[model samples]
Target: MDTDLEILLTNDDGIDSPGFRALHDALSEVANVVAVAPADDQSAVGRTMSNEVSVEDHELGFAIGGTPVDCIVAGLEALGPAPDLVVSGCNTGANLGAYVLGRSGTVSAAVEAAFCGVPAIAVSLHIPEEEWPREPAVEEYAEACRATRHLVELAPVRGVFEHADYLNVNAPIAGEEPAPMRVTRPSTVYEMAATQDGDSITLRDLTWETLGAGEVDDPEGTDRRAIADGEVSVSPLTAPHTTEHHEALDRLADEY
Candidate 1:
């Protein structure tokens, strides 16, 4: 394990969330953990940075009245020294599948950190749909936090960032014992639905319902599948939007 490593921690669920505090406590055991996070929930806002934000001192660390991306910028540029690693979340809900990468504030914070040239990890917990409308206790995040701490302790020495810019980690709710961890890829399943009523339309995502039933058709080696199998899912990913060489575009440009 790396000794005396400085870690910058932030989350989309706000600085006061139980999941956030759980992660803070877990990481503090291994490194110098500084918490600079939103003053209130900023879920699903994705990489939205503010030109200015209000900052206040808190028991854990600093709190910013802005999005998760704002917290990362504030932490890196003014609040603290450049961190050896930036960790976002232990979020309230799972950030699974390829489609969710850009829509998740937790993952977006890690994305911003990666663009700033720091390795990052975004962690979230999968809660069953039946558990909604109930507050999750701090103990409920133990497994997720433990898995995250494990990666924080080992990923640096293993050169995980050499091949990947950031990691997206999701774990099932805490069980009697710590869950096993697995390397995985984002699942490709998309489950959006819409309904029109009179002059109104409602948009819904049915994936959560599927996940609750453990009936998603996600194959092996996918984040969703791993979580369904009662294991921690870690998806190593890069930050940049990649594009392959295109002969058609090249021909169009040449003709012009």
Candidate 2:
């Protein structure tokens, strides 16, 4: 077994963001870490990959002028030696629920790594609405750094990535004792709201505001409920879109 591990760390937040830097510094304690993140914030950009990416050098590592997916692909294909693990985020905010898993550029980096058959972890901090000070702050990301460190140190075990193609971690703010770590699935509940102006449509992100109010039907073990209850939520996710047998499609194929 390779005692020394190499880790590729990236985030949707720009390379200069505190969250990304904190995570990079913390993970360096565990293994050799490489940072390949966007030059600017790419949050909620999803798995979209830019055809053209410009790379620049940073103190931490390389900052690519592209999406999270671009960073991961460039890191794997051309950045450096292939990493033993890929870690995304220490994001500014939590990445929870089914709606977010598909849309979060932070998690999308991990998903992009999983597609390359590399084990990956995506970590984020859950900043409660009440926790925000009168002034906007990004200090809560330290909690996420702590969680990422713990997971990285302990990930040398069997089956750590066996069932979960990639791990999605959402940690509550700092000063909390180890909340019960629950293995969960992404919640289906979504708070997508949109409005129309005279000529343009206006959309709003209501997920952060309505963190306390959740759906009644949300199951016992889901990323949403686990986070709402102030626990560290760990959801195991698989890469690749699922393919299922379709009788109707099969009939159409036969007609062809």
Candidate 3:
């Protein structure tokens, strides 16, 4: 463990959430962990930022009345010393697949950190919808907390950031035994549908229903597939968009 390493801990779940506390406790054991997170739930808000956000003092650290991205910026710039790494989540639900990466506030916090030139990791747990209303026991997040801590210990020293800007991690609810971890890629499968009523329409994400039935059909080496197999999935990702020269565009430019 790098005692000198400082970690900025934030989450889409509010600062008071058990998931956030679980991660804070787990990481505090290995590094200097500072919690700068939303005062209330900000899940699925992505990288949305407010020009000015309200900040308040909290037991763990500071709470921002804004999105996860706001917490990252505040933590890095004002709440505390610049962190060696930024870790987000132990999120209430798994942020799986390529489609959700941009929609998850937990992952977005890490993305914001990556753009700041710091390595980051976003962690989430795949809890069945039925399990969400109840307060999850700390023991329930054991596997995810452990996986997150292990990654925090290894990523910086192992030069993981040399190739990837950030990592997205998901774990199933902990069982009696620890789950195995797998390096994975984001599943590209996209499925969504909508239904109409008399005066309204309902948007539905069918992936969860498919996932719950053990029918995802995602191949090996994908995050969704690894999670379905009860393994911790870690997807190394880069933040910036890549571009290539286009001959077709050049020909059009010449014609113009």
TM-score of each: 0.96, 0.89, 0.96
lDDT of 1 by residue, 1-256 (tens): 4557999999999999999999999999899899999999999999888899999999989999999999999999999877999999979989999999999999999999999999999999888777865667999999998989889999999989999999999998898987889999999998889999999999988887898876878999999999889999999999999999999999999999
TM-score of 3: 0.96
In model 2, the worst 10-residue window by lDDT is 132-141
lDDT of 3 at 149: 96
* lDDT (Cα, tens digit) per residue for candidate 2, span 97-120: 888888999999999999999989
Candidate 2: which stretches are off by over 4 Å?
1-3, 130-139, 205-208, 214-217
Question: lDDT tens digits, residues 1-256, model 3?
Answer: 5599899999998999999999999999999998999999999999999999999999999999999999999999887788999999979889999999899999999999999898999999898755544667777888999999999999889999899999999999999988999999999988899999989999978887788777889999999999999999999999997899999999999999
Candidate numbers, best lDDT first, in rank order: 1, 3, 2
Q: How are the candidates ranked when ordered by TM-score, highest leading?
A: 1, 3, 2
Q: After aligning candidate 2 to the native by TM-score, how far in Å is the CA of 109 from where it should be?
A: 0.5
Clash pairs (backbone) in predicted model 2: none
Global Cα lDDT for candidate 1: 0.93
